[model samples]
Target chain A: MQELMGLYTKKEVYKRFDEMNLMELLTNSLKVQMKHIHIENNQTLLSVNDNKKVYFILKGIVAAQKDDELLYFRGKNHFIGLESILFNEESELTMTSIGRVEVIEFSKAEIVEFLMGLQEGWLYCYLISKDLNHLLVRNYFNFQAKPYERSKIMLNDLAKEFGESSDEHVLLPKKFTLAILTNYLGISYVTMRKILETLRNENFIVRSDKQKEICIHTKLF
Target chain B: MQELMGLYTKKEVYKRFDEMNLMELLTNSLKVQMKHIHIENNQTLLSVNDNKKVYFILKGIVAAQKDDELLYFRGKNHFIGLESILFNEESELTMTSIGRVEVIEFSKAEIVEFLMGLQEGWLYCYLISKDLNHLLVRNYFNFQAKPYERSKIMLNDLAKEFGESSDEHVLLPKKFTLAILTNYLGISYVTMRKILETLRNENFIVRSDKQKEICIHTKLF
Candidate 1:
């Protein structure tokens, strides 16, 4: 993590920061107001602080959510709390560091002011404006199918994202516990288990010990 | 909708158009590229023409997303396809004009150019950059609850937003059919119905004709 920090100026907010100038302005704004923070592995990112400000991950990994029905993982160059700041509401997500980590924190007031001012980082302001507008629009879609189709699509997405090619099939990343999968998909554990079991029986997924992760071979939908 | 348009200018992106120079630059770029497009109510915003681009709504209403659990409504000043444009992915949501609508449309190439050439519209370019960063960060931590709790919270949110103020507690808006509610909550119709029935029996909600809509007299959760 320290090595990664040494690789560049602290003003670079993301790996692709140079890909666009708007990104540079955004990081610069955050840099001007940011408070450096650190947390131990498995510690809640907000464990010590309860003020609900946004944090930018300068280094290390974090896992967030169990509310949307699955655990989502994030790492370097990512940020937290735009939703709350954009909407003027509290963040609906909680985060825990995957390891010892470093971050730059910003008060909600500062971030909003930065956007409201729309001066130096106005480009970023436009994007987030577009994003919040999109988010409000997206909240209406992403789940129009029957649970069967919905869960199947999610499985496919997961497979593409986290599945590794193996001799027999694709192996899922280790952390997808049945509890997390069921919750993320918004299905009861029993129901999701039964669904997966049926898929296994049909040879869409490989039957294996529940203690281990899942591997998939075919479309279960 | 026309009344709402009369309340604002064509250049204001959010209510804060005049707030920053970057917003001005961002809007200027879009303004130069924007083509005035109109669609009648229920008309396809993109059902026929399939090139995906971000559109800023200037008048009337539109509802986007066909595959998600519920219908999302957008009105004048709202925009669509930002998620797709920013992420460089196909928009999974479908859209239709709600009544009659007018929009400012910009092609993907133009928007991308606008973002990349930050030296020109540095302000807008900056805003989108920040928004994407915020979005990537936000995806990690929006949920941290059991599925049951999460769904209930969504219900409370719906009631709070759409429910009307009547003497008999707040009545839900007319649009929340069980179909919409069940889909929005991502619960099976039978399960959601049973859950609501149980709430009714417990006096958290009033028994009502399922044919029309649902109303709540107490905390439904």
Candidate 2:
């Protein structure tokens, strides 16, 4: 521990760890112990049966797929690889970086060991539970929502995670095109465009600029 | 523990601890710790926000609902109250007895302490994960499938869970009516009847009797 601390302290690193989205779930000690890793764009960060590592995204996007099926379009602030780690089974899912990404890695053994420290470490369980709730509920809504409903749900999800609240409306985090929105909803671009047209007509959403930022006007679901 | 064991020894009051569902996931000591309860028809077995007990169904059917939405129509050999207990959050979903139901219940604290034992108790996590996977995937399939596809997917689900295998064909566990099938898939009975007619014409499924024991003629999916 001393050697690692010394190695990090020589202007190489120090205790003022940068605040991270998902890492806030960890205690300060656990925070410093987590190792950082970078994955290149389009790289296969984790593949089928490679379950030794578990991490949380600190920046950028990663897509989780099982065979040809897309499981999640995971992004920063999400606990990636959590499902597999919880069970100790080698993952059958493949995770690939959509772009250059940063993540904080934790060894599978260390995580289990930490979780096992039960009463003293119950927060870990709560943190994992929180992630499970979000991921599973989002997936459920995806299964239940119609194209128009899906558009609203996805927009709300994006806004909740990345957007800014204003006096009149909530603004989207970034410019999103028909293609991107359609992909998120697992629908066709034409259908998504039509849905957006309907939403605009109904005043559920409005395009903020040429850059495509969206302002949500009404709760559709 | 000894007193409880003696109390049960006067009569043979247990299954041979058969190779049934949730029991396989429990440690032996925990298995002995479970207490049995019977729920009457139309009874509220576990209401929303009641997170005190976790149970495994031994017989009969239970319906889990979140207000007007049906979450699951659970039958025997399934663990109930799993999600809430894993998160230690009170369940918002209400579980009601569809018929006379038998269950083996365990105290929440005991289960958590048992799980805190780790390695030996990790099976509980796996059990929970398997359930989560089933539910999330089912919800996803629900979102993706059309009425016809949803019907087929649901039938496949029933067959996988309750069907009996024979060389000639797979036999459904129970005689299900068009109403029941339609309700499970969230479609109209008329549409479901039409789907069944088409299935019979295509030889994908054949009804065994007026009671409606469906036989799978081919790989439907």
Question: How would you encode candidate 1's per-residue C-alpha lDDT over B102-212 as one tens digit per residue?
Answer: 887767556655545543233343334334434333322222333355445555555655566676666766545576666555577788867776666766667777635
Q: What is the per-residue lDDT of model 1 for residues A62-105, given as tens digits with 9 covering 90 to 100?
A: 66553333345555555655434333344445677655778777
Best by lDDT: 2
**Candidate 2 CAPRI assessment class:** incorrect
Which residue window of length 10 is worst by lDDT in model 1 chain A? A13-22
Assess each prediction's global lDDT (C-alpha) against the native. 0.54, 0.60
Chain A of model 2 scored by TM-score = 0.67
Angstrom error at residue A152, model 2: 2.1
> What's the true lDDT of residue A123 in model 2?
35
Q: Chain A structural similarity (TM-score) per candidate?
A: 0.57, 0.67
* lDDT digits (tens) for residues A45-84 of candidate 2: 7776677777788887777665545556677666666665
Model 1 misplaced stretches (Cα beyond 4 Å): A1-41, A46-61, A66-71, A75-90, A98-152, A163-168, A207-211, A217-221, B1-41, B46-61, B68-71, B75-90, B97-156, B162-179, B187-221
